[model samples]
Target: MRQNLLMIEDDARLASMVAEYLDQSGFTVAHAGDGHSGLARLAPDTGLDAPDLVILDLMLPDMDGLEICRRIRALPGAMGHVPVLMLTAKGDAMDRIIGLEIGADDYLPKPFEPRELLARIRAILRRKGEAPASNSKALRFGTLEIDRDARTVTVGGKPCDLTSYQFDLLVALAERAGRVLTRDQIMEAVRGRELEAFDRSIDVHMGRIRAAIEVDAKDPKRILTVRGVGYVFARQQD
Candidate 1:
């Protein structure tokens, strides 16, 4: 089945081009010229079906992309789980970080090649399609529970809110508990991509994952940093 995507961008020419490209790439694309219209399309009664993924521009006409992202995540039920890919201007590191922190599944800087965009979209969707390995259906560490079949996590019996990407990252680490995996290994394991030099996107996503699962985000115990290396999931959790 062809997946549906909603592109919320103010640039008419760019939107048209992107829509055309994505259409050719086996996706149905919907365009919203502004944040309000984007939100309206996502509304339950708007007659606009909810999209499988959302491509949101960092700069919208009536609202900041971060705000739109927040609204999308705040939506009820499965709507809140729809993956979001943010489009940001090059060198706008802060926006990218903030977007990820606010629940965006991934981001691409402006001037990105359509091929890269397609690759990222495929990666995100692939991650979403993943199920638990045949070896295990669920993983439990102390009070934290990761249900692979359901694609849900809970801490101390309370549900934890994680973006699709973050959940995959956490699972990747937890599956290799006690082993220190390099950034490259982790990214490849979860995203099927190699780590770029000086790329701190994983670190940002780690922080977000910790915030959702750790009892104290300031001092995380579940995912420990290895300083010069990468990270390790504590084999012993309490």
Candidate 2:
């Protein structure tokens, strides 16, 4: 079955071109010119199947793309789980970081090649389709539990909300608990993509993950930073 994709972009020409390209790549694409309309289309009353993925532009006439991404994640049930690929015209690293922190699965800067966009879209979708290994077992550290088979996490026996990307990143770290993994290693292990030089969105995603599972996000115990090397999931936790 073809996956349904919703694109929230104000550029008619660019939107048309991208929709055409993604359509040829085997996705059913829908376009909305602004954030409000995009949200409307995603509403349950619209009678549209919840989008399997979203292509969201940073500069919308009605609202910032980061805000849209947050609202999308706030949607109920499966609708909230839709992966978002953020598009930004800004070269500022902060924009991308904020996008990922708010649950965007991936991001691409403007003037990106259509092929790269397609590759990224497929990559995010591939991560979504991935399942735990046949012999995978749940990982437990202190009061935290990561259920590999169910792809769920609990802290102190309470559910912790994590985006799919964040969940995968956590699994990668927990699988190698106590070992410091560079950002490149973590990204490649969880995303199968090379780390773009100077892209620290991974750190932002880690911050969000810490917020979800840590007793104190500002003083995290589960995922610890190794100064300049990378991050490590504690083998022994308090």
Candidate 3:
């Protein structure tokens, strides 16, 4: 099946250009020039090919792009699973960090070349494929249980919904229960890239993971931080 793409850009000319480019590149593209209309096309009942990916711009006429992203991320089903690559005019670090915090898979600054956008999209999809396959088996680490197949995670048998990145981070740490994984190492394992010194993207992702799996997010037990190093999932005590 051809991958379907949702392009949410308010600029009609740019949107048309992008849609044409993606279509020419063999992806079925859907264009929505505004946030509300984009939501309508992507709304549950539309049965619209359930987009495989979304390219979103931060600046919109009717709504803030971050809020739209949050709403989409909060949705149930494959819609929420679909990867989003944010487009922003600002190259500020804070904006990128916020984008990651709100569940975007990737971000690209505005005025980016179409080819580069395609590359980023391809990279995100490739990582999505590399994610650990889900199964019904549970990894029991003390009071925490991760049932991979069901895509469900429980701490002390209490269930929680984890974002895809959070789930992957937990699996990586849980699989190597006793070892320490540096921020760079974790990012490489979870995101397929080694981020820079100032990059806290992995930390943000782990924060969410800890919140879901640990008894307390503030004073985490299952995943412990080793100052100036990285983090380790404490070996379960027998």
Candidate 4:
């Protein structure tokens, strides 16, 4: 299937080149030169199907990319769950961390090779597109319910906000229920690949997931840190 991709970038030349490159890679590309237009395109009333993935530039003319990402997560319904691959300034590790923490599925530094961008795009989609056969069933623990088929997590009957990647990560841990998983093990389980050196800590993502599900993120009782090892998802929860 040819995937539709939306690229929200201020630089026309870069966007043109990227569109051309991604087009040749069998993706249909859409362009929004500014932030507002990009959000408009994603609006539920726009009548166009939401793109499968978004390639977002962090430095847009009308709005900072982080703000846009925050807004994207706040969009009503499934539109808020669209996968995002952020483009950031080279060597800005903090920005990349912040992006992932805020729901971006992945991030690439600016001035990146088109090939790398393509690879990252594929990786993000791969993580979101396929699931182990078992996910068709819901995983429930006390008051925390994870509907893998629906890709939703609800605690005490209230929905918990989590990114697509984070949802998968949670599922990966839940499947193993009492086992302790190292960071690399968690990443491999969720991404189906070896952990990359450039990849940010799984710890950051863990924090985000906790914030969404735990009644108190500061004292998480569900997902516990193993200290000096990794983390373990408690088999029993309330």
TM-score of each model, paired residue for residue: 0.96, 0.95, 0.85, 0.93
Q: Residue-wise lDDT of candidate 1 within 95-195, one digit each (tens)?
A: 98899999999999899999999999998888888767556678999999999888899998999999988988999999999999999889878865544
Writing each residue's lDDT as its tens digit, candidate 3 over 196-236 gives 45877777777777666666689887888999999998886
Sorted on TM-score, best first, the list reads 1, 2, 4, 3
Scored by Cα lDDT, where does model 1 land?
Answer: 0.90
Per-residue lDDT value at 23 in model 2:
89
Query: What's the residue-level lDDT of 175 in candidate 4?
Result: 93
Segments in model 4 whose C-alpha atoms lie over 4 Å from true places: 133-135, 192-199
The residue pairs in collision within model 1 are: none
* Global lDDT scores for all candidate models: 0.90, 0.89, 0.78, 0.88
Better structure of 2 and 3 per TM-score: 2
State the local distance difference test value for candidate 2. Answer: 0.89
For model 2 the TM-score comes to 0.95
Output the worst ten-in-a-row residue range by lDDT, candidate 3. Answer: 127-136
**lDDT tens readout by residue for model 2, 1-238:** 7888999999999999998998898998899999999999888776767888999999998999999999999988778888999998757688898888889988998889999999988888887778884457888998899998888899888988888888899999999998999988998788655567787888899999999999899999999999989999999997
lDDT of 3 at 184: 73
